[model samples]
Target: MPQKQIYALPNIVSPANPVIFNPDICNGCNTCVEVCQIDVFIPNPEKGKPPVILHPDECWYGGCCVNHCPLPGAISFNWPVQQRAYWKDKATGKVLRDSQ
Candidate 1:
């Protein structure tokens, strides 16, 4: 009999928390893990994968992870609606909400 091998998937299936990472865009540089002040992210054991969000609730929303990423949009925040602002144009009278 032969034994089957198990493998860890590096792709991010969904947004784990407020800090969302695009797995396709992420180069697995581990920069996000290093820059996180609160230790919210951990390096993925599997190479070439985005870091895991270990402490999602602990994130301070400081934007350090996003600002430091070499590739734009590799890391982005799913800002809570409470924290997001909606503004209306005085002339257009149209309200615009922050992008998701």
Candidate 2:
């Protein structure tokens, strides 16, 4: 008889999620999950709900998930405060990041 061995996944803590899903806008299409190159998301168990961020730290800051989303506001990308780059606009005198 072979003994069954079970292993649990580690709960890794990250500073923040690079990508976030808007529950109000996301239609649970799973498009972002399919488009992610780094496999950062896992399908949500509940129907019509946004997918779970299983591996937020694995995100490569790629906008594929956001760009491929059918709804404009379904997915959004965020840069960690440490990595967020800001520059002063000469014309407007407003500090803004690349995304802005």
- TM-score versus the correct structure, for each prediction: 0.77, 0.76
Angstrom error at residue 42, model 2: 0.6
Query: Which parts of model 1 have CA positions greater than 4 angstroms off?
Result: 1-16
lDDT of 1 at 92: 95
Candidate 1 local distance difference test against the native:
0.83
The 0-to-1 C-alpha lDDT of every candidate, in the order given, reads: 0.83, 0.83
Worst 10 residues of 2 by lDDT: 9-18
Residue-by-residue lDDT tens digits, candidate 1, 1-100? 7988968978643334877789899989999898889888889999999998888767778989999999898988787667788989999999999965
Clashing pairs in 1: none
Top model number, TM-score: 1
lDDT per residue (tens digit) for residues 1-98 in model 2: 99889679575567457876788999899888899998888889987899888888778878888998989998888777788788898998998877
lDDT of 1 at 2: 95
